[model samples]
Target chain A: MARKALIENDALIDRLSATFREVGYEGASLALLSEATGLKKASLYHRFPGGKEQMGLEVLQEAGRWLGNHVLKPLAGEGTPRERIAAMTSELDSFYQGGRQACLLNLLSSPIGEESPFKATIRQMFEAFVEALASVIAEAGCTPAVARDRAEHGVALIQGSLVLARGLGTTKPFRKTLDVLADELLADLEARA
Target chain B: MARKALIENDALIDRLSATFREVGYEGASLALLSEATGLKKASLYHRFPGGKEQMGLEVLQEAGRWLGNHVLKPLAGEGTPRERIAAMTSELDSFYQGGRQACLLNLLSSPIGEESPFKATIRQMFEAFVEALASVIAEAGCTPAVARDRAEHGVALIQGSLVLARGLGTTKPFRKTLDVLADELLADLEARA
Candidate 1:
């Protein structure tokens, strides 16, 4: 039964994540969430007693898990810096689904009226991303400061490319960004090569 | 009478823009907008017969106007490329209120469900930004393709740094981005020099 529940929760999270990604945190109304998930309000409430906040938090946690497994893990994996980053690049392209998906980090980071309850979670995710990238950059023989700066700049390029991709209504910028990313991150390494 | 109406309209747009920037399109409720603007719903409806969509559009249009006057125009102004970019950089810092303010272009670009009515306006704003910046890069003696690429990369850095700043709850990244911007934009020129 516990196993059954785990599977069920995963399914629920998938549905909820889809809704949030489409409309953003504020856009995901209870009515819309219910319609999308095919779960009555009560059922959703029974599962997520804290209502939309809980749902959003759970969805965010799931994204964090994915990031940990797919993004952070690979960056820390056994491959060289180039191999790891290239792997990360592929995962990012898939994770964002070729720039067709909106980033939950951007969408749910800020909500109207009050501070977002997810700020810490969002911060942790981005921090982890930077740290992971910085590690690889450090491994590539850049100074710690250079590693940190490059990591931050890399994340900025990614987040900014998503915004640019969506604003321009094309994926060309995103693809172009990905193409240059590995080289950009390894510039210090290649400078000595 | 016309003058009075124009003044009132600008005031209304300011209030509405503030509200939208905070909550986003989906988060901005009639009640919240009414409360923020200190106007009754009926009065708001009276001013914006097309309702929330119209209000959002007007706010976006006002932002576009500000960009043209403050950002694009300065970039195209007579000066060395570095001087013009430096001037434009100051405007950007002020416009975004030293990274404390969220960008309307990022905020209003994507709406939940049924496409943003403001996409065209948002696109034009970014396009103008790129075009203006690209022109400066070209003037700095880079090829047109290189100019366009750098302009896009520069924008991605700006947009991404804003996201980074907000996520990290510090304006350091944003400020750092500004510091490096002039050099990055004119790297080609500096290389030849």
Candidate 2:
């Protein structure tokens, strides 16, 4: 009989996810995971029976779920498109900690993760996020192609600004880009209509 | 007597840099470094006497030099501003491998590297790149303030597009962003003049 997960709760996943996001997957060893979660190695193993790989997969899924709930879903939520976009941007600002946070997707989507079992999940989240944003843009006025392109562009802007914020050690670039891009997308649409 | 340095060759540094870029600092353990560079642990320690931390600092410096020499220097080279910007953009495209390759700076600027002794070097590289880019834009016709803002914006665009390209599992977004941003920054100046 297989042992079941009793303690791989949301809090456990959050703790592990922070470790993975702060370092990359390869860096988060069993010892480090234990240190991070205040759990013994055996306890962590009991929670994540498959070890580091399983922990990574669960963390990746959690990140995707968070994005779905906080960003993608909000973008697709009902409101004036402008209001929806504004709310989504606010979620992004908070999610990224005003650009001081490193993006887990960027961290996990690298060559180190080329063979990760969860790699496809990262790509799917990105596509879904883009699709949600593009839906709002297309509904506003842009052709489907243009809206899709803009949505992808917006994703890059968010991820890259996080990189810049971390690099330049300033929240200004990330904050400004978010506000600027949001206005360009929503305000421009309002003007066009 | 302290042993004089005999190893720590540039080629070894290059190999380690690639590993770091792929998996990030915390991910590139001494064992992994040995695997990536085909060097024995003793040999790597002999080369980098201070161990992984020493190797990391050297790699960070090398990345800065490469950016300065290739990207920033080209942007400030002698030519019409438009010509100079075009050449720099081409260099950026190649350096990033059509956005397929991960950025070493982004890899190092993560939370994992927050305590890295070389963090300031990363900031310096970004500032230098922005200054080089701003100089060209200012020469083209924009006010100094406008040029600087645009240069920062361009940097964010480049970095963000890389994140997007990697996430979307395609180069089209990266390439399109490069072309579109380049046109906005460069070609428009000529049209206005």
Candidate 3:
């Protein structure tokens, strides 16, 4: 019974996250959230005592955890730097569903207050992502500074491609960027070879 | 008096656009919009008879006009491809206010319906932007296809950097990307030289 409850909770979060992604924070009204999750307002309140803000915070937390597991952990796993990045890109393709979805981070960030706890959560998530990618690039024999630079650039490319994909109504830009990411991040190592 | 009214109208749109940039579409409630424009709700409705949707449409149209004049027109101006791009980059730097501003295109696109009139407006704006950049790149010795690809990539870089800047509360990524943009877009020309 405990295991079933945990699974149900996970499904609920996924539904809530999907609604947030589709309509953004301001658009995700109580009516819509309840509709999406098939839960009454009172039940949702029971689950997330602080309401939508708490739900958003939990969604961001889950996203960070997802990235850590799917992206950062693999970057630290056993493989060449290029291989690790390539592997990670495939997972990103899955995470983004091949660029059909806009990023929740980009969508949700604009509505929150400057002092909102979400800001720190998001910044830390990007920082950790960059750090993990930097370490992998460093393993490719670039200096720490260069690796850091490449990592930041890689993150920007990924984020930017999603924006383009949405604006232009095509996934070509995102898919093409991913194809080149491994090489772009490890150009120094490639040049040596 | 007529000129004064026109100027005030422009300023009003600017205020509305800034509000959209800050909080996005769903977040830009009637109360908030009234606050941002310093107009009563009825006055806003008087100006934008279609209400928030109309205001959002006008904001997008104004943005496209601004981009055409500031970015595309300059790209087609009589200067070397590299010089044109540099000047345009400077304009962009000011337009984005040194990356302290989040992009309205990225922020405003999320909440509107998929079939929203705003989608076509946004897509056309980006397409025009990419086409202008591609022309400049082709003038810098890249083939037509290559120019288009580079242009798309360049747009992604700029858009992505803004996302990073907003999330990290730092303009370094945006500034760094702009600094390298001319060279990155004109590498083929430089290589020939």
- Top DockQ hit: 3
After superposition, candidate 1 runs with Cα above 4 Å error:
A1-7, A111-114, A190-193, B2-7, B111-114, B190-193
Candidate 2 stretches with Cα past 4 Å from truth are A1-8, A186-188, B1-10, B186-192
Score candidate 1 by lDDT: 0.84
Candidate DockQ scores, in order: 0.53, 0.56, 0.58
TM-score of chain A of 2: 0.90
- Tens digits of per-residue lDDT for model 3 on A30-114? 9999999888888899899999999999999899989989999999998778889998999999888778777878877743236
Most accurate candidate by lDDT: 3
C-alpha lDDT of candidate 2 relative to the true structure: 0.80
- Number of the candidate with higher DockQ, 2 or 3: 3
Question: Residue B26 CA error for candidate 1 (Å)?
Answer: 1.4
- In candidate 1, which residue pairs get closer than 3 Å at backbone N, Cα or C atoms, i.e. clash? none
| Native RMSD of candidate 1 (Å) | 2.7
Error of 3 at A70 (Å): 0.5
Worst 10-residue stretch by lDDT in candidate 3 chain B?
B1-10
Best by TM-score: 3
CAPRI grade, predicted model 2: medium
lDDT of 2 by residue, A72-143 (tens): 888878887778888888988887778777777887776623766767888898899889989998888878
